[model samples]
Target: MNTIGHTIKAARERRNLTKEELAQKLRVGTHTVEKYESGEQIPSNQTILKLSTVLDIPTSELLKKQNI
Candidate 1:
């Protein structure tokens, strides 16, 4: 099963962005990004919106979690 972290990681990869690059774009610390990808933390809704924008994916897509 996929989690939000997996979705975030996949989307970031699809954009060819490293965690550091994504963190810079999101104005967050690299460790924060790492935590998000590692499923150790969950981003706020505001951050999720930012992720959707930065990743060029829909908010709904970011919300999805399933076997992909």
Candidate 2:
């Protein structure tokens, strides 16, 4: 299964959003977003909720295991 980082990266790309743009929306640093996409860091529950809203995807979808 694809990791959460890959899922987040794919979702962000599908929405045509840059890491900086998403970071702005999430009120976090660009590096933090980069870490998230790289699987070097995992977002907190609150951040996950924010990501779902920002990405316009369901939280369950974001949390779901993806076939790699």
Models, CA RMSD each:
3.2, 3.1
Query: What is the clash count of model 2?
Result: 0
* Model 1 ranges with Cα > 4 A deviation: 66-68
TM-score of each: 0.90, 0.89
Write candidate 1's Cα lDDT for 27-63 as tens digits. Answer: 9999999999988888898999999999998988877
lDDT of 1 at 33: 98
Task: Rate residue 22 of model 1 by lDDT.
Answer: 100
| Prediction 1 TM-score vs. true | 0.90
Give the per-residue Cα lDDT of candidate 1 at 59.
81
Clashing pairs in 1: none
